[model samples]
Target: MRVSSIYVDGYRRLTSQKINFEDGTTILAGANNSGKTSLIDLLRVVLGGDGNLRAEDLSASARFDWLMSLVDAAIEGEDCFRALLEDENVFEKVPSVVVRIEVGYDPDTDDIRQFADYLMDLDSEKSSFYFEFRFSSKRDGMIAAFSGLYSDIRKAVDDCNWRSANDAEPGSSVFLVLQAKVDAALVNCSKPEVFFSDESYSNVLPMSTDKSFKRLFNFRAVKASRALDDTSDDKSGELNQRLIAVAKEDKNWEGVISKLPSRVVEAIHDLDIRKLTTDETLRSLNTVIESISSTNGAKQNDLFLDFHVTEDHAVQMIARAMQTRYLGAGVPLSEASQGLGYSNLIFLHLEAESFIRSAAQEENRYLVNLVVLEEPESHMHPQMQSAFIKHLLSRVNEIGCLQAAVTTHSSEIVRLSGIEQLRVLKSEEAGCRIVDLRKFHTEEIADKPAETQRLFSFLYAINFSDLLFADRVIMYEGDTERMYFQALIKAHEELAGLRAQYISYIHVGGAYAHIYKPLVVDTLRLKTVIITDLDYEKESNLSSFEKLKPLLSTNATLNEFFQDGKKNSPPSVADLSSAISADTGVALVPDTELAAVAFQMQPEGYARTLEEAILATLLDAPVWTSLTKKKWKTFRNESGLKFSIPREPESPTITQIVASTSNQKTDFMYSLILNSNLVEAVPPYILSALRWLDS
Candidate 1:
C-alpha cells in the first residue's frame, strides 16, 4: 500500500543499489553529497520519471557531450568508464541501469506486491540479488517482472542462444503481462499517492501570498462546456448551458448565499443600482455580488472574485504572517522564527505536505508515501527542522503513509531520527551505492527498537550506523521493586546519585524482561547485576540464572565464578563447597547469605558436617560488627554482600565475609566468595577495602 522499497542502478554518484523498507515509518539519511539526491533521482527514474535522471535515456551524442563537460572528452574513454563502473581504478560502462530491491508487505496484491510475498524471501541464496547490487524488485510487479525478464535475457546471452533464455519458459511473458494488469488494476505507473492532514497541507499552500486572491483565479476555470461533435462557439455555449442545467440538479447556490457575509446578503437583495447614488452604495453592491460569486459558481470562470482587506482584517493577516515567519525547526529544537535560520522553510514544508495530502485518501493519509519535497526544510530554522521531524514522527500512525526518502544533510535531523531507516547514499565505483539501514545488524541490545537503533548508530561511529554501542545508556529493572530498593541503597550509601549520572535506572517495560541480553553484552560490555527474586529453577541443582551462562562466558572471571559454583536457587549459595557450619542449627557470618539459607531451611535442608572441613577452611567471629552501627537487614540491603572479591568495588563488586558470629556462619558466606584455585586472588588492600571505608 506504500512505497515499500527503492532500487537504483547505474546512476550518477551511485552504483547498483537496493533498499528494503520497514512496515511502519522509515527514514533515509546520510551525509552531504552522500548520494541522497542520487537516491532520490534513482527513485524518480525507477518510478518512470524524467528530467535530471532522464539523462540516461538521451542519445549517445548528448551523453558524450554531457560527460565532456565534467572531464576531458579524451579521458572520458572506455578506460575511464571502466574505472567508474568497477570503481577500482577505472570505470565500466554497463548497458543497463543498475539498482535492485525487495519490498515487504502485509496484504499482498498484484498492483504492488506487499513485501511479505516475494518469490524468494531475501534470505534465499540462489538469488544473487539477495546480496548482489544487481537485482531491483519494486512493489509494483510491472517493474519487478520487467527487471526479471531483463535479468533472464542477460543470463541467456551468457548461456547458449537468445531463444534459450530462462525467462523464455512457457507462458512466462504472458504471466508477467497478467501480473502487470493486476498491478495497474488500482495504482498508476507515475508517482505513488501520499496522504496528509489538513494542517500539513495548508502549511505549503501559498494562498496567503495573493492577498488579492487572484491566484485562485488563475486556477482551472469553467467558461463553457464543449460537445464532442459541436463546431461553433454558439453551439458550445448551448451545450454548456445544457451541462449547467443538468448540473443545477445538484447545485446549491442557496447554500453559497447563506454562507456569505450578512451585509453582502442585504446588498444582494437591493442590487437595483438606481437606488444607490453614492460611492459607498456602489461599493456595497459590488462587495456583496463579489462575495456571492466567490462562494457560488466556484467552478465557473466568472465566479472568481477579489477581496479588499480593511484595517480590521490586517491584524489577523499580520498575526498569521508573523507566526509563519517566526516558526522554528531542527534537532535541538526551538521556535521556528528565532531558532530557525532559513526563510521559507516552513512554507516549503507546508507546500509539500499539502501536495502529498491532496493526493492522499482519508484512509491512507498517515502513510508518508513517497515525498518529493525539494530541500523544503533548508531555510527558516535548525531547531524547527528537528522539531519538524519529531512532530512528523509523533503524528505518524500506522494509517499514515509509508516511508520518506528525503534529500537532506541536516546533522540535527540525523541525530533526532536515530538511524533505523538511515540509508547512506554514496557515489563510488562507476555508479552509486546505497547502504540500506535494514541491511545493517548490530551486537548492541537488540531487544529495544530505539536502543538497537541507537547502539547501531553508536557502534557504527567505531563501526557502522548500526548502533552497537552508545555513549550514553540507561538500565531498566525487570522488577520495579529492585529500582526502589536500589534507590534506597543509593540514598543510604556512598555511591548515592553517582551511579545515576553515569548509569541511569529505569523500570522494566513489561512482566517478562526477555530483552536480548546477547545483543547488550556483545556491544556494551554491560556489567549487569540482575537482582532477580530467587525463584526456583525448574531443574534443581542448577542456578536460577542458568540461562545467563553462555552470555556471561564472554567475561573470563565471571565465567569461572558460576562454573565452580553449584547450580542453585537462593539455596545454591549455601551448596557451594567453601562454606562451613558450627553445628546443624545456624551457619553464621553475614546477612547477605540469609536469602540462600532461608531457601534451604524452608525446604528442610541442613548442611553436611565436616570436621576436616573445619581444618579445611579456618574460622572467625563478629569481625564485621566492630565498624559501623548497622542492623543486619540495613547493612545487607544498603551495601549488598555478594561474594565480592576482596578488592574495592571497581570492575566487579567485592564482599569480604568476616569470621562468623559463632564461628559457623563464617564458613557459609566464605564458601560463596572464594574460588579454590583463586583463594590467593583476594589481595591485602582488597580485604581492607571490603571493610566499611566511610562507615
Candidate 2:
C-alpha cells in the first residue's frame, strides 16, 4: 500500500496541513522557510520515527505564548481556566504531534490490501484506511485512561451508528470504535494532570522504532545539501557508510569471506611468548590459585592481551579509480571533472537500490520502497538538472514497485518533472498550505464547459511546462516580431532587466494570442503582457493618398514614388499600410465628422496595426527624413551609398517615402529603432505595455 496522503499537525509550522502523494514521483516545491523541510521531517518521524515527539518539535511561534500562559494559570489556581484549558494549554499539547496517513490500495493488488490490513487493523472490505498515530507524553496513559472508562465506552459504542464506520461493507464493524473515541476524549480533556500520569513516553506501535510496521512503510531521505557537499570516506558520509554496511552484510559477501584461508590454532600456538617470558610473575599466582581452587579440573587459565582478525582490518583498498575510458584509463572519483559529484550521488542511490531489491527478493516485497530527495539540483546547471531528474526517476522506476518524492526550488526541476507531479506549499497566516497540482488539474477540468475544455486542450497540446520557469511572459505575434522585439528590448536600457528575470517571449501569433488568456490569467497565474496588432482587412481611401501624393510630388527627390502617374495607383505597400498613411492625413483634417468615416474600413480603427501605431507617433521632421533615407539605403539603394528619398521631412512627404521603401512592417520598425532617435519617438502604448510588464 502507498501512502496516499500525510496529515501533519502541531509540529513546527505544519499546523494542520495535508500533503497528498501519488504512487510515482511527487515534487515538493516552494520558497524557503515555507515548511518544505518540516514536511520531510514529519514524514520521517511519522512513517519511521524511533521515539516520541521531542519538545523542540513544538511550533516556534506558539511555544512561548503557550508555556507562559500555562504557568500563569497554574500559579493563579483558577479551576475555570483549567476547565476551558483544551483550547489554550500549550504545554499539554507541546510535545504532542499527530500524524495521520491514508493508506491506499488497488483492488487488484491483494498483497497491498493484506499489508494495509495487517498494519492498520482494517478488514478486507476497506480499500483505504487512515491510521491515526498520536505521539505524546500521555500515549501510554491514554490507553490506560480509556480502559478505566470502558463501562461508559461500551455504552457509547452500542449507541454509535456502526453503519457509519462500515459504510463500505454495511455489516462489517470489527474496528474498536469505542476505544478510538475514549482515546480522543481523554486527550482532549482539560486537566492533563488528572487524566494522564507524569511519565516519559514508551515507544508506540506502527509509529515506533520497532520493525513490526516496516513491512508496509519505509523511507530514505537524500538531504538538499548533498549536491554541494563532497561524499567523504570518513564517518561523516552517511550514504557511503549505509551502502558499505549493506555490502558487508550481504549473504554473498559472507559466503565469499568464509572461503578465504586463515591461520590455524596450532600455527598461532608456536608464538606463545607469554608462557616463556612470564614464568617468574605467574609461579606465585599459580600456587595461590591451586590452593584456593574449587574446580575438579587440573587445567589452569591465565589472562593475556589477545588479538582477532576482522574483514575490515584484513582487507584494504590498494587502488581505486573510476574507469571511464575504453581501455580502463581511470580518474579518481573525487577528482573527476564534469558532473562527477552528481553522478557519484546517483551511484550511491543505485547501491541503495540494490539493497532494497535484495530486501524485495525476500518475503518483504510488500513493503513500500520510497526514495525521498531534497533539492537534487544543488550543484547542477540547467541542462544537468534536467538530465539528473530524468535519469533518477527512470532508475527509481527500474527498481520494482518503488516510489520517489523530491523537494526542489529549481525551476528546471519543476518543469522537467512534469507539472502534474508538483505539490506546492505556501506559508500562510493560518498555517502551511499545500496545493496538489495533479488533484487540482484532474478535478477542475473533469466536467468543465466544452468551450473551456477546448482552450485547455489547446494549451495542453503545446504544453506550458517551459513557461513555468519564467517570472513573467510576453506574448507577441510571428517570428519576425519575436526577432526584432528581442533586439529592441536589448537595445533599450529601460527594458534590459527582463533578461535577468527570464522573461519568456512567446510567439502565439495574432489569431492564437487570445487563446492563452485563460492559461496565463487562471491556470498558471502568471504576469503576462500580450502585444498584438489591431488588424483590419479593408482598402484605404485612395482619395487621401491621391490628395497628398501630388502636393508632395513637386519635391524632386520623392518624384519616382509620389509623382501622380509615375507611382502605382493602389499604393506599393499592403492595404493596412495604405490605410494607416491615409488615416494620419485624416487626423489632420479640420472637421471630426469627416475624419471618422475616412478610415472606416480599417480593421481595428485608428492605429490598427504595428505599422500604423508607430506611424501615428509624431516624429521630428529631421528624424523622419533620416529614417526614410536609411531604409532606402538598406533595401532599395543599389550602390549602398545612393539615396532615392528626400533628406527633409514633411507630414505627407515622409509618409509616402516610408510606404515606398518599406515592404514589411517589422522591417520598418527594426530600421526605425536602429537609425532614428527612438527615445523621443516610440509610441506611448508600446512603452506603457513594456513598463507595466517590468513593474
Q: Which candidate leads in TM-score?
A: 2
TM-score of each: 0.33, 0.59
lDDT by residue for model 1 (252-288), tens:
5335433445544355447843344445455576677
Clashing residue pairs for model 2? 536-603
Candidate 1 — worst ten consecutive residues by lDDT sum?
215-224
Worst lDDT window (10 residues) for model 2?
192-201
lDDT of 2 by residue, 1-695 (tens): 57777777778778777778877788988756768888777667556553434445656555434433333333334452243243444235433566666666676853764353334433556566555656554444543443344344234334553222222221224234433343354444312110111111132234332344444665677666543234343223334444454565465876665443244233445787546545666677767777666466665565343445455433332012112221224634442332445554555455446545554554445666676877776666778778778876777567546677888777777766755788877666666767677776677765788998777666654645555445677777656556655666767778877666666667665556545544444545556666655332333343343322322212121222122344443232233234333323221111112111012112211343444444445432311233545554454443222112554542233345545445555555555556544554455545555655665
Clashes of 2: 1
Error of 2 at 490 (Å): 7.6
